[model samples]
Target: MSKLILVLNCGSSSLKGAVLNTENSEVLLSCLGEKLGLPDAYITFKVDGQKEKVDLSAQPDHTGAVGAMLDKLKAMGLDSQVGAIGHRVVSGGELYSDSVLINDDVIAAIEKCIPLAPLHNPANLLGIRAAQNIFEGLPNVAVFDTAFHQTMPEHAYTYAVPRKLYRDLGLRRYGFHGTSYRFVSEEAARFLGKDVHNLRLVVAHLGNGASVAAIKNGQSVDTSMGITPLEGLVMGTRAGDIDASVYEFLADNLNLSVKEITNLLNKQSGLLGISELSSDCRTIEEESLNGHAGAILALEIFSYRLAKYVASMAVAAGGIDALVFTGGIGENSDIIRTKVLNYCEFLGMNVDAEANLAARFGNAGIITTADSKVVSVVIPTNEELMIAQDTARLSGL
Candidate 1:
């Protein structure tokens, strides 16, 4: 049956929505719904070869942005047949291992996880609730970003904290970006014409937010991000890994509160913190070429840390057979990819410089020589499609 699935990836600052036709596997409508500069916000719908941007002045908050998103879709003739609205919830904790129909209980459970992903879960709930209110009879499903990593073993997920804290507070390594990692990993296997269960892969998802996963035998044996997305590689604004005592020291010396420290780690660190310039990698790359020392340092730290983590994850999985790069920075930044691959030569990574340089954005291909020991692939991530496919399968749309 033909089905229309609307995928919603809600974040602390913006809502990214896409309408996909499962029958032909085409995108009908896709947009970035952003609320910025005021209580009034806007939604830009880019789909089906058409671009429409609407200014929604003063409608309160994220719910308002989502409402604007629906209004625009309806105006663009995509509202009536939407089979399901698939939401990407950041931290599903240990509750959900896959996508399911969103009900009141599911909503409550997601809300309960807000403390774990304070900046994300609330916005995700807003998107879900707004869709329920606007779309009415359609089934709204929750596809968790953490669900795919639930297969991670206890040894990889356990923290060395007090047992009570882990037992009582559910403090463990619940990885994020599971949807992206799952899609890219499967794509890597397809590109190699190999069964997923037969491949050991290290997928580097580099964007404003970055994470690495060690996928062995088609399952996530270990991933970089832990408990929250803040624990992985340096991100646009997040601090990846810092000394545990840094938080305490900030609280005592800087007179910061726990909430303040959390905000600092989640919003003020990473590339922005190290470069003291911009969070966007493209911007940093440009500035570094222009002799910006901070930008150079940020790029070095980001790529070196990525290499270090990829190597570590390889150890977690015994050894990696392939290194797959996805996400924005992973696909477009050839210089960064080259630098990362150079550092990974110990794993027998041999870059085909011509192939790496000739690669274009949005296309996947081998970036390593045919004789390279560890195959290197640049596979673009398609999280929206993954979310839509899961939503359709689960909703039977």
Candidate 2:
């Protein structure tokens, strides 16, 4: 039988899936089911070089989304012979050192972690449950977003909080976006033709939600994100690393509720709040070019912070050989990359401006000058494919 693996990444109100033909190493079908305002949603699939968007207005949640995707796959001549199902689980605590098959105990442990990622874990669970229901008796794998960072030591992962709270509430740093980091780290190793463990590298996963990680000997030594995704580099909507006292001040002075504060931090902040414009990097870039002060400031702060964090991570790794940029903004925004590299000149980093600008959204080599001590690279991350591969390995396919 042909081996195929289905990878699912679930958000608060949406589900993203990729059906991979593991034998051929191709994505057979990829779809996103969005649930914004309406009770139901629509799924858009990329199949056979054609884009097909289907309205599954009858199904309300992720289970419905999975069913809809399955039906569409069947219509396209795909069947129920899937070899495995992989879920991008957001938090794995310290229990999971690597990808593992999902059993009832795993599900329960994931449930216990919901408080750590209230907005994400439920959706992930729904996806897992839905896939389990749709593909009965099939091997399901849980690929954690925190698994790759399990290598971080106490000096890097610990918070300054009291020891009791740290022990009781599990309040130490549990860096997110591990899947992206893992994929690109391995890819960087492949591109350099060196064992990943031999390199001292830092990876920046700069998307709508962004973070930076320091990898030493192929193990995550440190990362910017903390106990939640809300900490790290500035994001499209998230406030990232803000003063903790702000929450208390707002609650006491402005009489704001916790939910309102959360909404503001998670939705109304970041580039959107600072720029008073769109949260998208493309829009921010356009507006900055037009001399929008806030937009320009937002971009400046974002780049400056990224550069500063990359330098700090270098300290943890002792020194850096390569700095990799990935995700949406990191891969596509040449202006941002240029700004970041310029700020890192003190660390012996220099980007070939012409080359940096030309490498946008393409798989290219080093944008940094050969004479520079630190080489800068742009690598696009493929978390779905990584999950599929992990699923295949876990299923013994």
Candidate 3:
């Protein structure tokens, strides 16, 4: 049987799985299980470009979801072909700097970093355990989103706070979206027909959870996200880079606890808070076109902050040879792209209006003029493929 690698990215309520041929990176099957443990739980799978949906009569948890996914693969005679499993672990802490084989010690280390990623590590552990149970004796690899950023310099990852805090605890910047950044940076270099090691690039991963990174010679030099995913560019619902004093201010005036304030920043702020409407950028754009004041202001803040971060990342790279955009919004939203590029005109990044509009629908193309100093291109990210490749290599597939 041909060897295949299984990639699993688990969330608190969702699980995304993909089976890819180890030799070539061709996806054999991909599926998503959503609303797990809820009445509306459903699993959608696509194979050979055909999609099918299976609705669970009873709410299924993560274990059940993985079982259903594996059962479907077995029905297609792919169970025995799956030689390894790759899991997307959100936070690996300082202990793990690269993808590693999952074992009891690895699981214990992941559990130890729970406080660093209270929301994601547990769900990742759950997926890892479930896959281990179902596919006994098979190699399972843990790919961390924070692993790529481990290359950052001490000054870049360190906070301005007390030294003891960072020494005693890992209170330092650990950027996220590293998997996407790594894939897109390499793709950007390939698209530019240049060696990544000789390039200085800035990558903006704009999605529900957005961030920017400075890639110096193909390695992450600095990134927008800090110790948590909540820090950095304003996201769908996250209040990024807020004034520290605001916490105490809200506590005194709104009589909110620290936990409540954290919740507000993480779930109730950003575009949603500014516009007092939906967090979806498409909806905000439509409202802005219809003369919604709040939406207009929200978009302005989002684009301005993004451009500011892009410029800052360029500084971190010393200079930028190319600026790449990827992720849901960065890959699709021409309006947002135009607005951000307009602010970056000072950096000699000129956008070809037609090309900007043309680079949509999963098309990867340059959106900047030929003579522009900074190359701007949109490349859709495939984090699953990256995970599969890592898993295959580490597991000796």
Candidate 4:
């Protein structure tokens, strides 16, 4: 069988795929389908650094978009070379500790996790089903974001809710961004020339959806996200770590229903809510540079909360040996990194200003002084590559 593993990330309005040669770490092809189910839906294919945009207005659903992607691969003579399919699923609940080859039972388990990740699991299920239908004999694998964090201790996962509720409903903390954390943490250990199982790491995965994980002895000891993605660090649109009673408070004060309150918190809050502008971090950073008050506050709050979470993760790890940054914002925002490190002076991280500034835009390196108590580095996350590797291993490649 060919070693080319096709990795798929299915979101509510978008689907992204990349075919990677697992043996050589080369990306043979990549494509993205966006605005699915909308009139202006389209898919973009990138080959040899050249991009081709294909209009998908007539076939504006996930199935059609996925079909287009497969057909495009066939046109490029890469369809038969793909050995296995890897899917990025947001939540596998407590059912999976690692990636699994997709089967009917696996699909049912993922379906059972719909309540845990309503915005994600349905789309992922659709992608898995679509791939299975089209690929026929190809092995499809489910690589869950929550799987890597499954090693979190019981105390860290258990909520202080009713025992019966947890027993009956599986109510517990299931942190996300596990794939990113696993990749970055291992990369950090490799950089330090130490075994990953011997290092204590606190990783900040700051993308549109953000979370922090405390990894101890190569396992997740604790994390920021709880039963849902909302109970973690402040994100692009999520109001993370809010008091549960805020729901009732809003219902009474604003005469809003539970559904309306949920939408407001999950979709209308976070950076956009605070800045009263775009949720894009680049936009906020640029406006902050221009002295826009809302943008300034948004940036400040973002870094401040992230610093606080880093401190919390350090404590959970019994004090961290190194701090790793990944994801879009963590890897690119030098301003945010500087602000976060300034707040974390107590950690004795002597951040090299020049090094931090130079570690943006896909650059990866240490950003702290050689003698600093804690090592800080930016490691760009490649969840797709991680998923592809998992697919390769589980598919007997």
Candidate 5:
């Protein structure tokens, strides 16, 4: 039997799992449990190029979901093949700078970060605990989404708020999507034929949750998302970079509580709120093409704000050698890419319209003119693979 590394990412209402060959990082099996803890919950698994879905009438929680997934793996005679388990943790909160072996102390630390990543860390902890229980003797590793940004300098991560809030409460910039950034930045360096330690790059990870990072000499120098994932560029449901006064205005005029306002910003804003249609960018783009005013405005705002953040990241890097677009919208949306690059023309980055459109569906290549001052490329991010590799290494596989 082949040694496999199981990579698990647990969201608020879902759990995604992937089994990868430890040696070459090829996915051997994948599954997703959606609507977890709800009556209509279901588990979808794909193996041997075949897909199957099973409904859970009783509504399994994360633990039950993991049990179901394990049963399937065991039936395939792959249970003992798992060498290590990697969990995608959303926040490390200065407690961890890199992937670490899980233990009682690690669980406590992850619990401490729940306030920093209210919606994500708790779900992550649940998955971690469940994996620990199921895969008792196997090594478990945590690959944090905020770990890569720990290299950011104090000035880059510190907010203008009172120092007590930061010192006492651990309130500071803890940028998310770091695993994706780490993978793509290294990949970008490889594509440019330059050593990662010597290249300066700007990465735009635009998806449901979006952020731009200024990577200088293989380390994150600065990033747009701060304190939380809600402070960066416009995202699917997040109202990013809003003025602080809006919270006050909403409280006074709209009579919204802090929690209510936070829910509004994180769950109901962004493309969904502005477009008043859907949070999915593809939907908005289609609507924009069909002359929907709200969708047009949403796309315009997303692109324009993204372009500005990319430019700002270049400044943070002192000069960018390359610009990388990754994540769902970044990798596939030609319309969004073109709109963003149009605004970045002043930075000597010219987009090749044909190349941009051609580089979709996991095809990664240069989308900029040969003589362009800055190289622009699209690279699909593989956070799962990155997590597996990290787990394999940490587990001594």
Candidate 6:
């Protein structure tokens, strides 16, 4: 069988597909279909490094999107070599610890997880069924985002709530961004010339939706996000790490329902709520440099919380051998990295300003002085490639 894996990340209205060759880590083709079920639905394709955008008719859905992309592949004569279809499913919810071949039973298990990831899994199921229809006779694999953190022990993922909630409802921490963490941690170890099994690290996966993970001996020990993505990090719009009583308090004071309060925290809060500006970190950083009070405060809080979480996560790393940064803000923002590492004096991280600036924009390099106790490195994340690798392995391609 060919080593090509078609990795698909299906959002509620967007689908991102990539054809990657695991042997050489080359992406042969990639595409994005967005605004499905809307009148202005469109899809973009990139084959041989050139991108083309195609506008769709009114009310295009997942099946339509898949068929369109498959049509492109067939035209390019690349469809026949696709070995398997890999899917990115969020919130495996203790049902899966690693990537698995997709079958009827696997589909059912994924359906059971829809309640846990209502915003994501349904769309994922739609994509799976669409792929099964359009890419008939090809093997399908499911690579879950929660798989890597499955190694987390009970003490690390447990809640302070009642036993009934834990046993009956299965409410506990199940961190997201496991794929990015897995990819970057191994890459960081490779860069350090150390086997991952011997390295202790804390990684901050900072982006619009962000989280921190503590990996010791190359296994996840603890993570910041709990039960849902809304639980950790000051994200673009999410008010992470808030008190549970805020729901009830808001319901009383603002005359809002529990659902409305939850929506506000997830959609209206975070840096946007605090700054009343925009959710984009770049914008916030620019405004802060211009001396905007709210933006300045937002940046300060974002950096401080990240530093505090890194310090807390270092305990799980046993002590820190290195602190690796990935994702959009983590990879490209020298300002953010400098602010965060400056607060890590207790952890022995002395950020080298010149090296920190040089590491931005797809450049992977050490951002700390050679003599610093904990080495700091910036590495960009490749989650789709990770998904493709898992799919290729699980599908026996």
Residue 318, model 4: lDDT of 90
TM-score of candidate 1 relative to the true fold: 0.95
Q: lDDT tens digits, residues 7-99, model 4? A: 889988899989998888788889999998899999999999999998898788787777888898899887888888999999999999999
Ten-residue region with minimum lDDT total, candidate 4: 1-10
Q: Taking the tens digit of each residue's C-alpha lDDT, what string does model 2 give over 1-397?
A: 5878989999878889999977777888889889822665777888877988777777677888888877986897776667789999999888787999999999998999998888888889999999999877889999999999999999999988899988888889999999999989989988978799899999999999999999988989999999888888889998888899998999999899989998999999988888999899999999999999999999998999889899999998878989999998988999999999999998889889877987776565688998998889999898988999999998998
In model 3, pairs of residues that clash are none
**Per-residue lDDT for 237 in model 5?**
99
lDDT digits (tens) for residues 286-373 of candidate 3? 9999999999999999999999999999999999898899999999999999999999999989989999999998999999999898
Q: What lDDT score belongs to each candidate, Candidate 1 first? A: 0.87, 0.89, 0.93, 0.90, 0.92, 0.91
| Cα RMSD for candidates in order | 1.7, 1.4, 1.4, 1.2, 1.1, 1.3
Q: TM-scores for all candidates?
A: 0.95, 0.97, 0.97, 0.98, 0.98, 0.97
Count clashing residue pairs in model 1.
1
Worst 10 residues of 3 by lDDT: 56-65
lDDT per residue (tens digit) for residues 130-195 in model 5 = 898888889999999899999999988998889999999988898989999999999988887899
* Tens-place lDDT digits, model 6, residues 266-296: 9999889888999999999999999999999
Which one wins by TM-score: 2 or 4?
Answer: 4
- The parts of candidate 4 lying over 4 Å away from their true place are none
Give the range of the ten consecutive residues with the poorest summed lDDT in model 6: 54-63
Better of 3 and 5 by lDDT: 3
Q: Any runs in candidate 1 off by more than 4 Å, and if so which? A: 58-60
Clash list (residue pairs), candidate 5:
173-227
- Clash totals, every prediction: 1, 0, 0, 0, 1, 0
